[model samples]
Target: MKEDSVLKKLSRDWRVVLMVALVIFSVIAIGPHFDENGQFATNLQYGLDLQEGSWLQMEFQAEVVTVQTGQPLQEIAANLSEQLDAEVLPVGPDQIEVRMPMTEAELRPLFEQAGAEVVAVNQGVSKETAESVKRVLDEKVNSLGTKDARVNVLTGLNGITRYVRVELAGVDMETANEIVGKQGKFEIRVETTGDQTQHVLFGDSITSVSTPEKDPHYGKWGVSFTIDEAGAKAFQEAAISSNAVNDPQNHELIMYLDNETVYSAPLTVELANSLKANPVRSLTATTGTGDEGLEKAMNLEIHLRAGSLPVDVKVVGSGSVSAALGDYFKILSFLAAVLALIVVGVVIYYRYREPSIVLPMVMTTLAEILILLGIARFIQQLDLASIAGIIAVMGTGIDQLVVITDEVLHEGRVPSPSVYLKRLGRALGIIMVAASTTIIAMLPLALMDLSTLRGFAIITILGVFVGVLITRPAYGKIIMAILSK
Candidate 1:
């Protein structure tokens, strides 16, 4: 009857119900399942260290400098570009981005020649250019059909992006380099004689490239792009010179990216007649109908943009992990986490020596882990460092539970209902203070772009938050119910 009464009181408690609901929700989010080969898998994503992959850290070859110039910024930028033989553009008020690496000494003279005084020279690209580079890399990686990829821009404390890192899963260092090292160079040429072709224009002439679209009438897939006036005139001149305006079928226009042909199609009769009359600015490269056409059109869109970054880059660091080694690390990480939980449970049992108290503490701690993993599955990828953080959270969680147990059982005796409530509140106050301090300490690491350590810090901070917010209060309510019986 006492046990039944305890169960009834616990069932009525809202805290325990909330904890249970969260556990169930977490399990669903994790979505653990077995693959066809009878191997376990889940929606949880693992980092490069926990899976087969390669990583490349690349430094942008660019600089941002403040200048004082009486000449128009545009003129100075163009003159500086011509003098340095590099891409230079105005970024902000009195600031310009030179898309090449150079020391302050080398830049000062050039700025002076361009009628500008160099105030400061920073060895990194501006934030906007960095983001543009990231977008281009993202498109290139996606076009290659890589399974999982991560591109992170590492900015210094001075708010300049010096390096960008790319992580590709299920690939080697060579393959990773091939993907990120070469920037696409797009060219368009028109077929002349038997196999000879005449150059129409380079990718620089392209003004805009749009997303793939389907033709409503014919169900054909195509990518539309607009070219500059010079490009249009060049295209018209090429068509007239190659006799393509009269014999459209014989004179196929070919597109190449990185010296490899990507698209070839003859101009339609209407387009040929339009080119005969005047230069055409907008054009569509049509692929065949269906899914394959849509896929081709998508790739064509990326190719048309040339996948060119605003600034050049140099690979500074790279590494790779084989599938076998990754599997070994994954197993070790699992074992480490299990060992931590077991050791914590044993210590808790020794301290309390009572099945009721020990069981609730262990169960509560496990629940905390579940909620943490569930939340992490959505926001962060699991890695060896993050697994270490999980173990650390386990130890800290047990300590907080012990504090609660000792506080409520003051003078080695179970407290009355009124006394228990007061003690629980005080215990909660202590836990909150400790949680705040832990969060404060981990905030910098969690927020910074410190690569792997960021994961560890984030998991630690998240674990602390889950414990204080959800599991601890529930454990307090649950322990009170059992002790009252």
Candidate 2:
């Protein structure tokens, strides 16, 4: 009869049903399993701080400058590029990006010579260039097959990105640095008569690579690139010698990055005819049609650049954590979480002096944490800062549960169901306000790339939502039933 009563109560309460469903789903998401070595494990990922890894923070050696000029924007950019021997790009109506490091003093003279005056200079790249740099870094890191790697661009409020942070797990500091620092060697080759390829030009011969774009007329995706005069001449000679101009169908152009063929396609009839006439400085490599074409075009652009960032970067900070130290930190973080829960339980017991009340509060708080971790298993990696956020969540969870308990137990007796519902609504109002405040405060940290604190802020925000939306209401329902009895 008692078991039936408990089942009936759970069935009657939607809050209980939702909470139980979430708990079961969370447990499955966590996926606790034994390894081949018969050791307990979980699907929860750990960040660099919790695993053997190295991290590097690199600053771009470039600057974004606001300029006032009477000259044409393209003319000013061209003159500046010539004078500084670096890539100069116009970012906005009055903003120009210099792709090499130069001080105000060094750039002031060049601006005057180019018929432009420097309004202000900031040590960073434009947002677009920063994204390109980030993409290049991602491709380079991923090419190494490093399973766990992250690249984050740190942008400022003014839309300038000054720094990029990279973290690689299970990699030593030396290897990590090498992987990031090394540049791929790219080459262009022409297919010979019988399954043979002859090299035309190296990556250094390429001067510029444009972003992938779709041809409006044909809707085919392709990347445009510009080669130096010598490279163009060499390419023409290779095509003519290979008889690709006369028999374009049998001959194909192959692009290689680090000796790996990244793209291979036959020359168009127009391109072959043009090559037969003269060297072409500008060339486009068509991938294909549709989304797959666009994807391939983007990859080809990366290959054409040979893993070179649009702006140079200098390592400003770097560090490593040994496997043993990471393991120790992981153990410490686990102990801290366990200790926090125990302390919360003890304090709740001291306040209520009832095992029934204290146990439910502590258990509900633990359930909130479990759900948070389970969700994080898919979207986040546990680190020292995130663990601290988990502890903070525990603290906040207990405080909110106490509010619910005290509100329901007002006048030292359970009220009627109608009054109980009203009090629960009021308690939830308080928790909503508190949760909103916390979410607001952490919003900036979560959105901004402030190193490790980003993880801290994100985990804290997730925990608050889980507590306010899921666990707290369920706790209210559970405690109401116990107090009513």
Candidate 3:
């Protein structure tokens, strides 16, 4: 058969054979389902936003004595840390400290309130005990498979008492409470000491949250509001009758963060409409319990409740890789490539009289492109440098393929096809010189800090490499056969 004879002639070239082999090899390297943790093995790295983790803020009870021992500062810190079994950061030489979350169960409730004393906290670490908390944090980091993260410790002062602060960056809301600044559980039964027992309630009942303009003249960050409709009327009555006692101390609505009076101020503004009409001019609204008793309504049982904080964060720095830019870069690279191809194609066509001789190398150039992209997606971040490398590799492939085309098909220079191999040797020498110069030119980008530009340079150097070494020879072998045809 005439077709069988032509196919048999083409089959003699090993280039076609090797190209098929590399394709099969690449498929095996990146195919199939991967486990969650095993996804790391697939060479697709995710950014921090893509990863799931947590941010935490723990607050400690201000005035609490755990042990009866009247020990010195160092002894107290050591004993406290030992009790919690986590990291304990002390505020000063005298008082105040913190307990970072170390375990899932470190914040569970333990006991219930009794006849006006207080309840006990259950199976969780307290500032009284927790020494190896830092180790737990380290283990958590290692499990994430990332080296990038942020941590900070701070102290808050009020001219009266100092409070401890801790901050960990780049975490989602859900995981934050685990690293609570304290064992954020307080259950105190009250009798108001020698005078009248202070109103003790949960901090979890803040019906509304807002930054209100309490005083336009005193420009400062502040939040003000009235309770829900039902609670508002009751709070109004309590403030009206108690308005005469106006002694700042007794009239003060003491606010606490886990049982510490962070704020204690006298009832000032009186909302009269709140008492009669459930004023919907309501600065804000919150769903409230039906309790209309003055004490019960005003006792806003609330806790900061591991709520989201007001810490402002912004993406001040970022690197974006636009596919549009990629396409434009690709087009630019393509133009340069097309220009290079035209120069080589012109020289080769002038030299090789047969069109059949030039066609196979053109096909080989396309194959080079597939191989370059496949490798880039496998090994490194597919950035601009990789694109540059791909373009460079494509150009070299065509250039060398042109060389093979000329040497093997030029009827004026050769009588036997065997002599054509010698021309390939000289062509390879020329490729080496060109590739070396390109690689040297790309070296500066590798050392530079331009995040966007580095990827381009990296790809360029690698492309020149593959072109000079493996691809050139493979292409040379294939086109050598195509030219012989």
Candidate 4:
């Protein structure tokens, strides 16, 4: 084939190869979501570890309830703390509560352990039933869009009930506080595009929402929404208003929340219960699948986008990335990376006794860094920790590259390339163990509830593995050829 034809062929077919590789990579990156009850895909989630020190904050809210019979305030407070799995502090002798760093999932079990119930009136509960209080708490916790959060309990004044406090971290403070304010109230409003129109849609009917193509042809993205019965009624009414508008220009309804535009478009076909009849079905996986599995995910993603809370966010407590701090961190990181390169470079010189070998090691080291930065931007966000990790891996790669380089350049006097690789494999086995140990030690922390720490651990582990697996080998191979010349 002509070089142009070959290039075109590669360009044409590269997507297939990339797709397959990406699918595998995505599975490694986001597949863990499928194993969870939520069926979440981590594909789009920027792990905090990857972007550590970007922004972080924690906010606290307090929930009040009545005291039940048979428990003193102090005991009840203590009990509530245990239920919430947080430390309770006595705000007052007769009333007290607590706060802990527990996530949302840990609350109910803690409540059950405390033998307290969630009461409605915020008043006295008979000494009789602690189960109700816990059930209420459990219900509320489950209803919130989170499975992880912090909770605590306190005694109420006048023997009214327990006061509970929840602490949320790793989210913007404004949004988090708004979420707490909502108390998990599922609110939906159906409204037409204009005050003159009489159509609407409700929250319950929304089976899902999709932007389908990340970007649309019109320069404006289109979104599809599925409605349940209650939502269908509201949507139909809103559509009817659109139909009522005699002016073609007015023949559309808009969706709004808190007096702000969310979705607005012309009302076309009306559907009965099922969204498959809707014209935009082709773009939506959730609508066409008939699988309820996607419904919750769609709802969650939609609610985050359409609701008050943002699906993506800015760091809550990233008060100021001190130009001073950034400067300091950059200097240290640069020093460390340079120091590593120098050490590796010196080692290669000591081992190979030639400038040819040393030069390639330096090139391979720089190449690894470029590849790491590219991966961080496209595949994930890069933070200081991950940068540190990448630098460390680069240093490690130099040593391995030196081995492979040494092996390859000597093949004429030694064995063949494959034979040299075989000899190199023994050392690689040791390298693999070292890399594996680092990755294994990081697994638990990578899986931590602390998103930043999780990102740090994950990216670092991946960086080390990538250095050892993909980049190191290729770099070493290329470096070996150059050195042999």
Candidate 5:
């Protein structure tokens, strides 16, 4: 009868029930299981410092400039490109991107000569260009069949992105460097008779590559690209010399990247005739129609760029961690967490001198940490900094539990149920205020890309939320049941 009453009581309390459900769900999400080698493991991922990996930080060698001009923006950009001997693109109505590194002082004179004034100059690429660079890097890394990689564009508050960082797990520093530094060599060749081919131009001759789009009239997916004047003339000459204009079926154009043929198609009748009369600067390579065509066209676009960034990048920093060292760090992290919990339990026991109070407090805190880890398994990878945050959370959690225990056990004895309820409310109010302050303090660190601190801030914030919303309230109800008994 007493066991039944206890079960009924637990069922009556929604807080206790919710906590029980969450704990079960957390255990499942963690997915602890035996590996093929009969070793115990969970679905938890570790970051660079806690796993074998290599990291690289690269700085973009480009500039974003604010300009004031009376002439048309395109005309000013063209003139500036000519004088500076570099690529210039308009990013906004007043903001232009200079592909080459230049200081404000150096750019001012050039802007004036081009009928424009340099209002401001920042040493980085614009946000759009930075995103493009990130995309290209992501594609390059994924092409290597790397399962674990992270690419981040670090942007400043002024909207200029200055650096990009890449982290790859299970890779050595040398291989990582080679992957980032390598560039694909793209070439176009015209087929003469049989298997004979003549070189037309290289990737350097290509000025720009556009995203894949469908031709509305033909319902075909293709990427459009523009070539320089010299490339256009060379392409026209190659076509005429190969007699591709008159015998389109017999002659074909092949595109190669790194000496491997990626695309081969006979020139269209219209394109052949046009090349005979004039040099074509703009050309389209159609993949085909429907979803498969769109996918192929996207790949072709990446091939056209040849793994090149719009802005140049210089490796600013590089590092690697060996697997043995990473194992040591992981062991240290686990020891730290265990040591922290032991310390908290000892300190709380010294204050209360009661096993009931100390055990529940420690167990509740552990539950909070478990839920945090379970959620992080899906969203984040644990690192040294995040582990530190978890330890800090344990400390804070014990403090809050102390507040609750002292409040409810006022006058050294369990109070009436009504008084216990009032004290619990007051204790929760205190916890809410403290949690809000901690969250607010960590907000900037979490939101801003402060490098390593970002992970710490985010983990701390998540811990606080889990404690306040889940474990703390459940602890309160469980303590009430224990004390009333």
Candidate 6:
């Protein structure tokens, strides 16, 4: 009857119920199952160490500099671009991101000539440009239909990105090289006589490309883009020479990306007439109405840039892992995790010499791991370092649980309910302070762009929180119930 009452009491306790519910939810999230090939699988994602993959770390061939100019920042960027014969993007009120690697000495003269003072120079691109490069790489990877890929921009404390890392799972080194190196060649050509076409401009001439937007007037989907002055002149000349402006239907304008025809349509009557008058810098390539058109328009927007990154990049480091090696690492990582749990359980059992107390500690620690993994499944991919972190968390979790056990069992006698509550509160207070210290120490690693240690730091911090907030508190309650009897 006492045991039944204890069970009923724990069931009613919100902390115990929450812990049980979270464990069930975590199991579902992990979803341990077997594939058609009889291989075990789960929703958890593994990093390069446990997967056959290639990783490339590329450095952007760009420089971020602080410039102080009496002229407007945008105008300084434009003038610097023209003077240096490279792309210059404005980053801040006094910062210009030059898309070419130039040293301080090489840039000082140019800045002086442009009526701007070079305040400071750094060897990287702005965060925005880094993100743009990442976006382009993501598009390229998606186009190739890679199953799993990750692109990360490694920024520094100064808020400049010097390197970007690419990881592609189940891909060989050579193929990975090709994928990152390949860039689409986008061309605009006008049909002259029957099928013969004359080139008007290349993707380099494109100044800006916009997202697919529905035309308010016609309800058609289109991508609006702007070209430079030179490109506008070339486009107009091609239209006139090809007689496209006169015979808009027969003389069609075709857009090609990597030699594959993407958009082929005659010049619109209005556009043809306008081109006959003068060069038009702004143009819109319209697709037909509805879902298909919207999809095509989105694709057209991607092709318009021709896979051009805002700044060039050079591969600084690269590595590949074979399937056999990855499998070996995976096995070792699994064994390490299991060994950690076993060692922790044995140590706890030895310390308490009581199954009731030791079992709850081990079980509570396991619950913390499950909850961490469940949350990680959706947010972070586990790597070898992450496994190490899990082990570390297991150790820390046991330490905290032991603290609770020792505090509750002070003087080797069952305390009254009021005393138990006070002890539990004191134990939790210690755990919270320890957890705070761990979190504070790990904050830099978690927030900084250190790709390798990020997973480890994040998982450790999460485990600390789970222990302090959920599992440890519930364990205290359950142990009190058992001791009270």
Candidate 6 per-residue lDDT over residues 1-485, each given as its tens digit: 99999899899999999999999999999999999999888988887888889999999998898987789888888898887777787888889888888889998898888889999999989886787678788888987798678898988878888999999888999999999988888999999997799999999899877657898889999999989999999999999999999999999999998798989999999999999999999999998899999878867777888986767889999999999998899889889889998888898888878898888888898899999999888888788888889999999998999999999899988899999999999999999999999999998889865458988999999999888889998999999988887
* Tens digit per residue, CA lDDT, model 1, 1-485: 99999888888888899999999999999999999999998888788888999999888889998999788888898788777766788878788988888999998988888888998999888886786678778888987798678888977776678999998988888899888866678999999999999999999998766557899999999999889899999999999999999999999999998788999999999999999999999999999899999889877876887986667788889899999999999999988888888888788788878988999998999999999999998888888889988988999999999999999999989989999999999999999999999999988888776367888999999999899989999999999988777
Query: Considering TM-score, where higher is better, how would the candidates rank from best to worst?
Result: 2, 6, 5, 1, 4, 3
| Higher-scoring candidate on TM-score, 4 or 5 | 5
For residues 103-164, what per-residue lDDT tens digits would candidate 2 score against the true structure? Answer: 99988888887888899999999888888888888999999798678889988889998999
Query: Considering TM-score, which of the candidate structures 1 and 2 is the better prediction for this target?
Result: 2
Candidate 5 yields a Cα-based lDDT of 0.88
Q: Cα miss at 92, model 5 (Å)?
A: 3.0
lDDT of candidate 3 over 1-485, digit per residue (tens):
65565567556656556665665565454443567777423333222222333333333233222222234545555554566543333333433333342222332211011011112222223232221232223333433443433332222222221122222334444344343322343221222224443443343323433322223454332334434454544444444454422333445554554455434444333433343334322332122233332222222222222122211121222223333443555456548667766675566567665666555565566555555545665554543345455566666667666665555556654335556677778778877887788888879776553234666677677666656656667766655554344
Which pairs clash in model 1? none
Q: In terms of TM-score, which candidate is strongest?
A: 2
TM-score of each: 0.78, 0.91, 0.38, 0.46, 0.80, 0.81
On the 0 to 100 scale, the lDDT of residue 300 in model 2 is: 85
Residues 1-485 of candidate 5 have per-residue lDDT tens digits of 75476567867899888877877788888989999999777888888898899999999988888888787887888788888777788888898889998888888888888888888999998887887788778888987787578888889988899999999887899999988887889999999988999999999999888667899999999999999999999999999999999998888899998888889899999999999899999999999999999878877887889988768899999899999998899899999999999988998899888887888899898888888988888877788999999999999998898899889999898999899999999999999999999999999888765378877998999999998998888899888887776
Tell me the deviation in Å of residue 33 in model 6: 2.1
Q: Mind giving the per-residue lDDT tens digits that candidate 4 earns over 401-457? A: 755655555644545657666756765676778788888988987764333355567
> Deviation in angstroms for 146 in model 5?
2.2
Candidate 3 residue 229 Cα shift, in angstroms, is 48
TM-score of candidate 1 against the unseen true structure: 0.78
Comparing 4 and 6 on TM-score, the stronger one: 6
Better TM-score candidate (2, 4): 2
TM-score of candidate 5 to 2 decimals = 0.80
Highest lDDT: give the candidate number: 2
On TM-score, the stronger of 3 and 5 is 5
For model 6 the local lDDT of residue 107 reads 88
